[model samples]
Target: MPESRKAAAAMSKTGQTEPSAPATETSAAMGGSQASPKKVSQTGAAVEKIRSRIIDLTIPPGSRIDEPLLLKEFQLGRTPAREAINQLAAEGFVKILPNRGGTFVRKLDLAEIGEIVVAHQLVENNLAQLCRLDDETLADDLERIQTVYRVEVDNRRYLNITELNEQFHMRMNQSIGNSFFHDFAQSTHRHVRRLLVHLYTLESALPEQQDEQFELNVRQHDRIIEAVRDKDREALTEVLPEHAGATQDRLVRLLQSNTVAPFPVKLRPLVLPGN
Candidate 1:
């Protein structure tokens, strides 16, 4: 059997079934107009498990991705294992190095967090301004997403919280009716979500404070929804920065509290020429 087929068989034995391939690929494989679910492919399964570990910091930032171990753990063959790594690299979750440096989880940069926040805020604000509130359904969609977000926050499901939060923002961005802005907002929102994964994980240690902060986020989402519903550009412009800054502020507090000693990634101070 082919390597991919062998990998698929191995994965099926382990119960980690692969997701269906895209419709185009399925149709082409079947050699007919009708498309059916493809057999479990180990590649997608490996990618998802590895990506989740990286995001949840289970793999830890900057840690080498062990291919042999992954193959054994996920019951993936060589081809599928490498394919999963390449897919992760494409998603910016893993870094591939030349000259046999080996692939590593992408490190979270302290300095880049601030820049990401700025970019996210800029994109979100612009998208909000451009959004057409003529569609009442847009506000309804946002409210629906916000409801789920609040539940995730209250439940302390960090991963779910970040994912739902991203959905909430992206739903708003979708109203802009401009693909360019929507895409830009998507990329920025993803960066923020990844960064928030770390922030939320660290905050998890402090139950009282974590609950308070999460409630604040819930309230902010509510405010954003109200702004969108009322078509209040000014309110959105003001609240959006406050919402973005909340994450930055929490990160600062986490660092200052000395609770995150040794930090997950390296930290370096920026130096200017004169200084």
Candidate 2:
């Protein structure tokens, strides 16, 4: 984007995000933990574990999140649990209701998916196109990132694969030297990571199918990385939409399937309320 255009776009989305809520006190504050290796709750480890659980879909979208149960299960104190839940809410994983308690991660319906694609395309692609990557060393870093994602694909587990995928894209955004889009893209992508993982989690897949899919994803990353390395705007532009389209289709189907469950809080019929 031209200098003026980038500024305008940034200004327009300035008010889109809000700060997350504060967390309650952790239980460990009362008594220190004794469990060494397996035990968590050292220092925000609870938070990290909860975050990981969400990414891994151990706790699927719409799954009920009872605080006390979580506390007992994770062996965390009130403060840490509160903080983790608050952070999860902030990250768009769980919805904290006034009286009903916290719910599990939320799904990206058609509308949210549309919003993501539009946001990614506008901010990410534009910044990428405008990026000046004359530095070959940066290309090396990208190649390393691509390598990591390849491993992630091979693993086919929800947690690490999706996390690495997000990191890969975030690194690409960061490389552009545009802090505004870089940060926004990272945060925006965070909210959608759970479903993205659900979309591609390896479930009863044949070796051949998994290998081909992983190969395609790796090649896609390579193409994008190469474009960035060469500062080829056309290649960057051509690859992103194509990549997102396949991703969108995959995600939509994944959400529609049973591989990654959507934890629908208080499941009910399809009746429109108050109809």
Candidate 3:
């Protein structure tokens, strides 16, 4: 099977679109019982913390989120705990099931990941062709983003690392000088960051491995920004696909080894487990 096909199968098997576990194995793995709470006093603070934890992968993908556990962990009450989940659901960070069943974190698999990779290619390539920004501004901004990512990664401030990375890419998109393209890039920022976030984090596999990958990424950013600076549309046609392909490669391997899981079908799934 092709790498994409293999990735698709893995994602479909693990995708958690709804709060319910679609796969028998995953559902079984999440097995147990926890008591529900009655009410709580404050929800706003509880929700913010819950949102942060889920986004930071503190809760982790596929880890069953029991409200009572959250209640106790955060020292909050039932109402607050429930509200936290509700907000997460709205952001597609966590999916809430109907009738008080279960909540599954939205896990994007390799295939859904592949699609986003392709989107990156489309946007970045065209952006490169149309880049009309001043070299000084682009260089300065890219450097700032790099500085932040390096500092955050070195300090183990993983969340900040992703935000910095996103800032760099968004700056790249805006370099295109097209309002429409800029809007598209802005809309996709959340999804792109969600995928890239894991890829950047997984490099913690080894000290050498992580540091080496970080250096290479910084170099890559330098190259892409340099391409924009030089108006190298030809170079970008070659570069952007390789960039996205690297993301695909990273996503496939990590999703397989770490069990990162696939996205659950929001509407009708184009693919399913074992197809």
Q: Which candidate is the best by TM-score?
A: 1
Across 41-95, the per-residue lDDT of candidate 1 in tens digits comes to 4676577677767766778888898678777888777777887888788767778
Candidate 2 structure quality by residue, lDDT tens digits, 178-235: 5555556666666556656555554334446445556777788888888887778788
* Candidate 2 vs. true structure, TM-score: 0.67
**Candidates' C-alpha lDDT:** 0.68, 0.58, 0.58
The model with the greatest lDDT is 1
Scanning candidate 1 in windows of ten residues, the lowest lDDT window is 17-26
Query: Pairing residues by index, what is the TM-score of model 1?
Result: 0.74
Question: For model 1, what is the alpha-carbon lDDT of residue 16?
Answer: 39
Q: Candidate 3's residue-wise lDDT over 102-153, tens digit each? A: 8877666645566667666666656655665555577665665565455555
**TM-scores, all models, native as reference:** 0.74, 0.67, 0.57
Order the numbered candidates by lDDT, best leading. 1, 3, 2
In order, how many clashes per candidate?
0, 9, 2
Off by over 4 Å in 1: 1-42, 262-275
